[model samples]
Target chain A: MLRRFGLVCVFVSFATLPAHAESVRITQDIEARTITLNGAEIVIDRIQDSENRLEGDFARTSRPCPPFCITPMTVAPGVVTLGELEVMDFLDASVAAGEGLLLDSRLPEFFAKGTIPGAINLPFATLDPANPYRDEILKALGATLTGSDWDFSEARQLAIFCNGPWCDQAPLAIRYLLQSGYPAEKLSYYRGGMQVWLQLGLSTHTPSGG
Target chain B: MSATARVTTTLNAPPDYLGGNMFLASSRRLPEISMLRALAIASLFAGITVALVLFKADPGAPPAAEGANVTRSSAGFDNLAITPTAAVPQVAQSVPQAGPRIQDQGHVASLPAVAADVDLQAMTRGVLAELGVTPPAPPPTDTGADDPLHAMSMAALSGLRKMTGQPDPAQSPSAFQTLIAQALQAGQSDAYIDALLNEAAGSGRITVPSALVTAEGRVDTHVILSTIVAQAAIASGQDIGAAKVSSSGRIQPGQQQVYTVSAGDSLGSIALRFYGDMSRYNTIFDANRTVLSSPDSLRVGQRLVIPTI
Candidate 1:
């Protein structure tokens, strides 16, 4: 009798236990450029052609995931990896050739002092957000922008660098180029940035005024 | 009446009399009485057995053999007494043993557990001290004009020297001054020269400008002139020259690119669309300067000028 009673108690206890909680889901639509979370649409404002501060904010908050969590859908052209030594060689060759444009994404103060020889200062802050000139600039130089109009596509051979590996500016700049329509094959990311250049024996320039 | 009295007398007679009396009395009366007595005894025995079985069958019955007798000569007596005595001692010993034993067990269990709780702040402080981290003394508050341009110039010269594998160029102010004179003679922008100086200072290849030195060893120049020059150059790039007149004289890129203002759009949106970025929205304002007083006053439809890149 006691054994039978114990069996009944066990069954009752098992029947009364609670269930587990579920996780929330967030989704994005590339064609419509919309995002949905938990069955509700989310509207994102302040997205520009040059730099999307909204996207940057979104990337920062999407923790435990890649910083820029775009969907798997291939909407924009991909990025190119320029080997470290090749980038260094390019810088040396550019100086010798006096033909390449050294673009710095650092603050204006950093650029004013010494930068790569013949480099131009086009701070990320200056790019046109609404109708980004990444395409136009590349086009002016006889280059092509890669993907969609909203993307940042610039020339393939262009070398983009920021402060260093620790800096996200260059990556964002590269992303901007890829989105704008620059061919993935032509672009090279110089991961070793100004710090590396400065560490190595390289040229820099400063404007003359006080 | 005579017959009933005789029968009663016979029934009441002693067992010996019944056995020894007439044949009917001996055979029938005594035998029948004995049979009734046997039946009564059997019924009583059966009732006792039923009661015992019922009690044993009860679920709440006392444990079997709980008070069972043991042989007096057995070792049980000694065991019982010794067990109580031994138990008393164990209880006394357990009081002290429990505290330390439990504590030791807890210590053993928690030692590894507590290891991971190292205080990061304390660790950082210790490491910083080991690394010779000292608070930097506050900068001098009194100096001449803090022209960022001059700083840039110094920085550029220092950078140039470092690049060329030469010794620090700012070691001799005269050489630096001569170099500046030569660059200026060669028609370098004054802003460019200042930037070079600032860059030199930034790179730690030059001392603070002599102009910054004041009486009592205090330096106070805080003017960020380099920043101003950079801003001016950026502004110049943003400014639209003569509106590029295509053969049709229409705005080259178009009056406005179509845009669906998203949730985050503002007047800055329209301006950035028409202009290259937000900074050149002022140029759009200048183009429509007659109508829109501020860039903020823009609707989804309002056509605006996009300045040349």
Candidate 2:
């Protein structure tokens, strides 16, 4: 009787196993189309593609050297060097909160193709000392003109980027900003820029949407 | 007795000449004189040939390979007599010409080393001023000229108009309505249109079918904006004592070109059209950071900056 009872128990256990088996889940890959930074959503998609291929200066394998060589790992002494993720975080903390600006330091041509979310187009050439429009750009960045000198007491924090590591535009703008008395500590360098951002499958939006 | 002996000896010597010794001496002396005279004449001819050759070999003379070869071979034979004629032409051509004339030739070669950097602003300013179009004031040294948007504001335009003796004018209801419709069709938010309209109303007043407006009959938000800008330019021009004016400042090449995105337009396609290379899409993207957050997000009719390459 005990043996028979034990066999009956095993049979019951076996019958019950199918119920639990149905409830057990199988792991699957998850692809996210959007990432929320702070309260804002960043769509991760390639900005410009031709026949399913993306285009632009950043698409080039090699750019002319001397002017467009890859920048150093650090831009300046006190400026923070940031990767794509760090840039997104900064975008959330600074741009979303309206505490700082995300500046696209390339020419308007480069900036038009696509850029990080929350970035404003401020061409590097516009801030170049030789450009007649430099002072106007400085004023737009919230610099106060005291005689011929600029005062940056009310300047917002700036996170600047250009084409990518190979682009010198952002570095030029940063150096000019520093020379113009912008606090280096308040500046963040998004060195990866649009190249790295797109490489990692991040979302981008057009200017019209903003 | 010695004198008689000497006279007899002289008479004997004369008879000895009859033995043909005198004839032998004359013959030897005549050959010596003739050989020396021939040598002297040959040296004079050789010197004359050398001087003539040198005079013909002037640098200003046109290149004549055959003539040069002849002169060179002549000199070689006169100096070293062993030089072959066949080698002289090659040697003459191979030798590089050297002289002040050669140096002068280099300077005379075409092409200016340093290009004149033309100041387009100064050039245009002169022409505009001569035409009674007062160019915009030179940028102030003080900070007042620093804010670019300041001069574009409604208050600034009104102030300029007041200074120019232009009274507040009425607007063309039809043109104004057309602007509103176009702005709405362009997908501008109502709030944005309202604000823009209010701003435009406050700035410069213009009427349709007036001589003050540009003849561009297309009534759109662009026309509306341009009308106000024109009014501002005219007012400012009057303030500066100009007889006529259309715009304030010249559009610089460094100023970004605005390209309207069309249907089926991608950054790559737009780049290929504007830059002649699809790969330069990044340039377009980088220029429009203010409007584009993504390369894929280009909208029809969206204005994009096509930056100068």
Work out the TM-score per prediction.
0.26, 0.36
Best of the candidates, TM-score? 2
Per-residue lDDT over B112-181 for candidate 2, one digit per residue giving the tens place of the 0 to 100 score: 1111111222222332232233444432212243334332222222322232233322221233444543
**lDDT of candidate 1 at residue B138, scale 0 to 100:** 16
User: What ranges in model 1 sit over 4 Å off?
Assistant: A1-78, A82-84, A92-99, A131-136, A143-156, A201-203, A207-210, B1-309
Q: Candidate 2, which segments miss by more than 4 Å at Cα?
A: A1-59, B1-309
DockQ for all models: 0.01, 0.01
The prediction achieving the highest lDDT against the true structure is 2
| lDDT tens readout by residue for model 1, B1-309 | 322332333334323232222223223323433333334334434443554566578856433222111111222121111111112222222211122211111111111111111111122222222222321111111122223322332343343333323343223223233334333233332223333433343343434322221111111111111111112222223111111111122233323433332221233323323331222333454456455443333333345444443
lDDT of 1 by residue, A1-210 (tens): 999999999988776642211211112222112223223343322112222122222123334334423222222255444543555455545423433434665556767765554344545443323332232333432343222122223222556666655555666655665555555655556665665554443334464441
Cα displacement (Å) at residue B263, model 2? 59
Docking tier of model 2: it is incorrect
DockQ of 2: 0.01
